[model samples]
Target: MRADADLDLLGVLVTRRGRLMEVATVLRRYGFASIAAQLDSAGGPGHRLVQRVTDRFIDPELASASAGERLRGALTELGTTAIKLGQLLSLRPDIVGPNVASALAELRAGVPADPPGHAEDTVRAELGADVTELFREFDPTPLASGSVAQVHRAVLHDGTPVVVKILHEGVRRRVLDDLQLLSALAVWSEAVSPIAHQLRFAAVAADFDRSMRGAVDLREELANLQRFGAMFAEDPGVRIPVAYPERSSAGVLTMEEMTGHVVDDGESVRAAGWAPDELATRTASIYLTMVFRHGIYHTDPHPGNFLLNPGVITILDFGDVARISSSKREQLEDLIAAVGGGEPRSVTDALLAITDAPPGIREDEVVDDVEAQITDHLTGGVDAIDLAAVTRGVAVVVHRHGLSLPAEIALVLRVVTLLQGLAADIGADIDLRSITRPFALDLARRRLDPKVRLGRAVRTGRAWERLAETLPGELSALLDHIRREGGADLRLRDPDGIADHLVDGLLTAALVLSAGELVSRSVPPKLGSLSVPGLAVAGAAWLRYRSIRARRAGAPSAAARLRLAERVIRSARRPGTS
Candidate 1:
């Protein structure tokens, strides 16, 4: 069972010794060769010798396996945390690429039902009641078992059907240990590697840590159910399962068992009298409504998560969801528009606006990537654009620029990708543009409503004000860092000129906000009642902004920003310089 190990005959040191040994064992078991060289934190002649590892060794079993297969196998062997990590990676085709991600999609975290009566014992302990007294009939067998909890169907004393979710014994402790390991690894990765820093591994790890912690706690799911139920209380088209708080506790939750056929079962969907076309359009609308109107949504859009009947769609599982702020939603709208319009520069601009690009990102390079993406996949035109390709295109650009997206935005994109996949699975004739157009129009109307416009204008001004206030402090920090690091003998060109530019930018920004305020209020000097002063102010602001932009013709591009960030990192690497 062992492959011949390469001997280095030197010593390499490592902390987390026991955990690292376990990890190395798993990695080696799964045929991951060059383990010491690839993942060795401190690489030296002693890396293998200190670790008693090989410089190169491949598992004969995995030599013919795809990279993804090897990864999936390794992760599966690692259990809960790794399975969840694989599931998350499956959603990110942009990071791992389509093939690898697709291969990872098969990871299932289902555990054997709570070892017979152990689940019942835990339920009684958590809810302070015996199963027989609480429910008219409690099923001993779990309907579904996950790494976190087990769900069993039960009926209340009132004969109402419900599902009782009981947390697995000590799952929290195991999950916590894994999350700690993951978070530490993320920090270490970011500290040592610029690529990991650009990818924001630390941020992703933190977010995943939060999500996983929430997952193991039944109360969080209870809260999510209550929040979603409140949101959809009046909407007949979309049904959120009702929660039974009286019967719930921190480790257990009881909820209405919604009855409908899963959408992934196509024949059942048809037999249930749901027209695929109508259902498809309705599903998209519901999701869009969640995004544009509700500002929050169930993160998972798998067809299996949706239960459909003739006139309604039931959304299951509130264990995970995402929320977007108004500003983020608007940025998403802009990105969608730019994607559909077939303008690479606009797409690039919108993408940059939506993501966390470095200070001096190269727009030209982003535009070129976007242009090629448009040529490759979007040239089928708006109505026929392959959204999956667009998603990949976006990932490509972001990765190419060493940029990172907000996790919510990435989840939204994942939802869209999943939704599109659902269309094909259910045999629905879908025109992506036509389906989105109505929602887009409604969003515009909602945005342009007088009250909404006014609110937006007010928020916009406050945001701009904050930016203006913070800019000098941020600039000072940057300069201080440069000086402290002795980076390029720090020099300034017309430092006070920055003050003038800031003032001009703030003034113009205010003028624009004022114009919106005027438009919203329909102030005096009317074209009929159209606020002539507002129009005039808007024009002036536009002109001023154009002039400022024209004068500053040397803005750094996306590529330049990336390079600059790298240089900054490199310069900061000097020993005790700062």
Candidate 2:
């Protein structure tokens, strides 16, 4: 259901039949006619009409394509928003299968460079000056073009080499429109389709929309670059490009340009005098530190995003990043520790702590699968293990058990996968366990620190104090209700007529209450060898014992009854002469 204002907006779009028809035609061509038909049938606030057109004319080439391929092709054809969504989906192997994720990974935005003067115009508009005013030299030709922005080589007046990233004109408006359409479709699909509901289409769409919108704003990326630079300020091996905020704006970013050997090029890296294995290890260590210590990390780990210049590793592209919460980070630490220690139960518990598993999923099965995967991968030693494969294997098990990884964890897993791929490409043999073990151990030790334990105890004390303050009042209210009603309401399911035992329980409760009252009032001793309270307690215990004995004795023994019946039958046979 939409509000009046939303309805008006939808009406405006409906008036533009050309755009709607274009979207429908594209969907139909991409083997998604069923979805298009659903949208088309849901027209203008009335009852939805049945789609009578059974003949769907799909593209012949797409007829034999796998579902992943068709989806990849459809997203590629749908433009920037769809491309960004595909890229995000590529990181979510738990939501989508590995096959779909792999196929989506191959999806390239391939946005052609805007016309020559477009970049200059954007720069002028964003910085309030022509390129000549801001830089000593500006190249009009773009170095690269992405879905959101394009970069150009330039130099500041101080003669420092830099890159100017400029957002495309009208891209924000276009992306917003597409996002609105997608959201609307998602809502409708979730309402009508079981698969969409299961996949949580609306939630994923909202997250994707937010991510894409964030990516479109150059200011966000600039902030990320600055934060990452600060994080690695003391580390000499890792280099984050310097962001020039004075020369940047919401739609424009200026950063130091990096020129070096791409990390994926093994020959080039070796020629540059860097050992591939050592470089890989260092790279893993840096990322691991970011995740375990800082809790903020770059999500993308493709080789193009890394540059090996001289002795430093320069990271690029801050457009996509993820932040992990402290609790999630702790869970990840536990998971790492458990995996390293080869504790399957602990690993399962840690994973369950971080992810949401479906009801009725067998924890033992998931643990067994994970343990098997770990054993298979680590049997040859940690150095020979593939971190990405291990992570993927865990992801596969999670998916099989109908569990969903949190978005942050999914992105982390994606980064690990990319790093592993990069390592393999460079023929680098690095032990991920060795890199993570120290951090895990340190975290475990920190958890057991006296200060941490004291803090936890203080928090627990406060929680208990609160409960204590409320418990007395709650108990008083319950007693008041029982008194007013003359008895407590109780429900019981008793077979074998054992509910008769409740009479003895009632007597015991009465005796206990009486004894408590007598003890509180300091009643005089009345029994021969005990005080009044002690005698009452003794009588209650004796009554309980007698009740138990009576119940057991009253129940007949099958063998004794059978023998008595046989004796009666034998006596009757002896008198058969009569």
Candidate 3:
């Protein structure tokens, strides 16, 4: 009954005639003329009410600010959905650009809280009980309200002090509607932009959909919390909130509440007589352990989620997390090695294996740019090298290469960046590179360890054994076909024809062997240092060179053309092959 009422209120709010106009006014006030224009353009004259509101509140001056700041303000004005997008953007500096990503990072904790009654009603509906019945005591007001949910302090019936999380009223519907609108905009942009071939806007929208839906699911959030808690169970310095398995539902989550001052707050740490720098370093080590050692990480490690106590840092919010498998973990280690070694070609190849990069991007140029940025920080003043600058540099490299990071990589970058900020707050006299290097090196070594190598060898051996068993049968069948097709008496008299036939047969055998070898070799496990886009260009370059070389080598016409035709056909079969 309570759920029905809550949903009814949401329905009314979404359907009300004045609601869209309210949203537009907020957007304009926040300096989002471009987005407002897109909305108006999509909605037509009926949306004039929104347009008029936008016209009244908008400041043309704000739009003229740096592209990044403008976007941050715009999302702020557009409310939760846009802010959620900004949060996603914060993780994806590669896609939104560094300037924008940095600004969005600053906006993560600023989302406005819904009215107290609305939040209370939401909690009641989601928990399927009144607050009093579910908790020893429940705070009516939210401790924090984020894009997806509001969290309140409470105690479970079992006397465990926990946080009760309730999804924001109508968040699901609003997200879906916003996603539909964003998808439409992407489609329109692709149709009109000359750069559409390079952008892959549709893919980005699809990714956004997947990320947001996962974030909004409370059950998934609970599972992540439990999973992370287990990973850190033996670590005395880190505390992950324990979820109440019996209480959590799709829209409600109950988890042990962790209390500590935020590590980013230096003044508070100073007041407590604690060493802030030590706390920062310890915090960074914790996240590094989660990412590089365990292969699972808290995706959203913005300072807000990190709380510092005397000997521990408690991580809150498991809604945004990434669990990388062994294969991807190995690839990431390789990517780090490629970055450290400054091998652009290897980086490019590794990046291509890991991500979907844009076409026509130059591998060497991207690698040079990334290397230059990291080298500058390394050789520059030690005091000057922090996580933020390195991250911004990485974002720049990602942008120049026209490659967006996968969600997992983006999350890792976010955690690293936040650690840098935490270190700076605590007066760490260390360079981020100094701390990151050891951990990264250790991970890389493990990635290349005998166990990893043995695993790769075993996989390859299995494939080879299968091929060995199958090949003789296949060859015998082919020989039988040739025999049945032509009795031994049938022979070609022309020398050129006979030579052509012999060469063609040999070439066929060689092609089969080459293909079989490729299949037998397991895919490389590590991402290389190059951006995905760079590798794609390198691949295209290789194909074009092969085609030109084959034509110039003075090979016979039919066989040469046939090989060329075969290459083209094969390339076409693979998506993203130029």
Query: Which has the greatest TM-score?
Result: 2
Q: lDDT of each model, Cα atoms only? A: 0.71, 0.72, 0.65
Worst 10 residues of 3 by lDDT: 487-496
lDDT of 3 by residue, 1-578 (tens): 33553454455556553645665566566545444343222335645565566556657677456656767776776666677777877777666667667777777545567776885676667767777877888888888877788888898777889888888878888777676666555555555543433446666677777768887788998988888888889888788888987777888888888878865466877654467766665666777788778888777655667776777768887887777776776667666665555455666666656666766777778667766765456444444555576666767777667676666666776777776666666676444455677786786587589998898899998887686446534644554454465523223433234534443453344344334433344433222554333443454455445545644674434434344434533432343332
Off by over 4 Å in 1: 1-20, 31-57, 358-362, 450-578
lDDT string for model 2 (204-257, tens) is 888888888888888999999999999999989888999999889988999999
Candidate 3's C-alpha lDDT? 0.65
| 8: Cα error in model 2, Å | 11
Q: How far off is model 1, as Cα RMSD? A: 11.3
Model 1 C-alpha lDDT per residue in residues 172-286, reported as the tens digit of each score: 8878877877777777667655556666777888988988988888788889899888888888888888999889987889999999887765677798788777777678778
Best by lDDT: 2
Task: Write down the TM-score of every candidate.
Answer: 0.74, 0.76, 0.69
Candidate 1 local lDDT, residue 369: 83
**Candidate 2: lDDT over CA atoms?**
0.72
